[model samples]
Target: MSSNGSVVPRVTTRTLQKMRDNDDPITMLTAYDYPMARLLDQAGVDVLLVGDSMGMVVQGHDTTLPVTMDQMIYHAEMVGRATDRAMVVVDLPFPEGQIGIERSIEAGVRVLKDTRCHAVKLEGGAEQADRIAAMVTAGIPVMAHVGLRPQNIHVDGGYRLQRDTDRLVADARAAEQAGAFAVLIECVPSSVAAAITDAVKVPTIGIGAGSAVSGQVLVTHDILGLTTGYTPKFTRNFAEIGKAIGQAAADYVAQVKSGGFPSKSESFS
Candidate 1:
């Protein structure tokens, strides 16, 4: 049973589709490590995405550009092992969808076989139709991304809100028609996100895209305020965990300085 006293079944791509049909809101979060993945899975998140955002969240990098496939697989393996109920989907870091179908197939197959993840998410749209179709044909479950692709950051010049409704809707449709199990709409207007949701038969997960979609997702570190410094405007820090951690460290320092840390109960003797 889940913490809510209900049965927690293993989440699947089809499960997300069913939730969309039933008007049930889906929940997804990015988790790169085993401990956090376990906690989030136990908390009943529907999906745990091992996002390339780890380059920024874990590696202290300025962009996700430097993240490699090997790094992704390593983190994904950890997240996949820790998850029991949540469907774990790892991102195909930059160039996975940009390249040809043959290499993409190799990458997708490797991720599933090596990490034991349920699915792979690639950033792209209509242009990636053949790749998405081919990956699905290879027995790889694909989650397609549309609107404000992060891999295109250098091309886009920065992280800007995507507002092209017709294009976004077309991308979502193409991904669904190409056999993507779900479409993730990111950093777009709520109306556009909703249109994409309406346009596609599959489930639409959103990040900066708003609540009108079938589900929502956020960088876990950003949500818990564990990520120091700037976060996206669309993100909300549900708890000041970083502050608490800092306070805990400060308290320990104070205790040690005051000679009160080695109390009889705490001492080895």
Candidate 2:
């Protein structure tokens, strides 16, 4: 039973596979709350990702690893309630939930059942391929993330672009073999991203991984021009809504101070 008194219809795994087979581009946006999810759905977004990136976007954390499964479930459930269209894919945050295949499966199933999401996403490639395989075998759909894995920030010393084209290619293949429906390529070279997309059977969604991949995913704040901090160079600002909002607020203040607001035209009879 869904919280909204409506049937929770799942975005089927077969629909995702069909998108891959048809070469249709997959569109995903990171949405943390119900209103954002509802707006994204109205805008015709194909996927609503309840990304653990929420730690940074919503909780003011420096990394995503600190987000717990309970938090993830709560956020996912929130987005699920507001989403009537578009598939919701929730993230499996670092360290806390992804201990092993069993742990991942247990966590993933809980997220799907509790939040009514279509799938779950995790960071890693070949090193986590076995876990991906296990999830698939357990009937859970998985989206594998490679390249700039935020969960590895502590070990990698920070967010750095991955080189090693050969290793990258191998990792992508491993992900495909592990039955990932799609793989997210982040902060890798365009040539490498293109090669990986071609080498794998599933689709590749790129984020600063260059244009050669099959699809694109961007953080909603960065794309909408609402984020407070510095955005990546690859981020293209479509509408500086943050500045617009500030200007609008300033105008309202001035209007009220000058008795320009609630004019005769706006005054109630």
Candidate 3:
């Protein structure tokens, strides 16, 4: 609980591990700006990720590859300012952590210092262990991303489910061994996701994986039905907010044109 008497406790790496141990499912959502971060924090989300997906969802980019570290830091700082309890994790962005171990550490440090986020999330698994290790050794908490990495979208052709159970399990294990506090399992078969979750000591957060993992996450825009086109099959729209917003605007315009709005009560005395 905070000084404001909020029931939501502050989320941290240790808190996430404890949640996994207790069989409590964690909740995470992406927020690239302050308003969304404030709403998610108020709703008691366990984690708020400033994901590189913002490149597509917010900036209208075709891929996350073009998202720069400076853009991530700018958005992350806004999220950090709005959130008080949820653990904030920002993506290190493409090529930032993939350049080399030294470059990875530099990126991680810059992200933490500039954004005030709790940790930096980088895409990769066994192949990224050395970089992950170096970042952790530099005192930067890292959240490892395994399975389908968006940073590798061009190489992989497109987003596809990872079916190699053995590879998934090995990647998760390697990340844990490399000192990643948690691993995000994305776009993998349910069986593979479950296998990795079971094989890893650290908490596994799944996106389009399944319920058997430690937790689940989704892009906030997708969940709220704010995304305009090509929604993923795994994404579930919980609300028709986009339609509602459009309807509200139409109603306001009609009322104003008909001189039915800003009636006596809305007028100044």
The residue ranges of model 3 lying beyond 4 angstroms of the native Cα positions read 1-8, 259-269
Per-candidate count of clashing residue pairs (backbone under 3 Å): 0, 0, 0
Candidate 1: regions farther than 4 A off: 1-8
Report every candidate's CA lDDT.
0.91, 0.85, 0.91
**Per-residue lDDT of candidate 1, residues 140-219 (tens digit):** 99999999988999999999999999988888888889999999999999999989998888999999998899999999
Query: Global CA lDDT of candidate 2, please?
Result: 0.85
Off by over 4 Å in 2: 1-11, 251-269
How many clashes show up in model 2? 0
lDDT of 3 at 143: 96
Q: Candidate 1's C-alpha lDDT?
A: 0.91
For 1-269, candidate 3 gives per-residue lDDT tens digits of 55587665679999999999999999999999999999999888999999999999999999999999889989999999988799999998988978878888888888888776889998999999998888999999999999999999989999888899988898888999999999999988888888998898789999989888999999999999999888987789999998999999999999999999989999999
Score candidate 3 by lDDT. 0.91
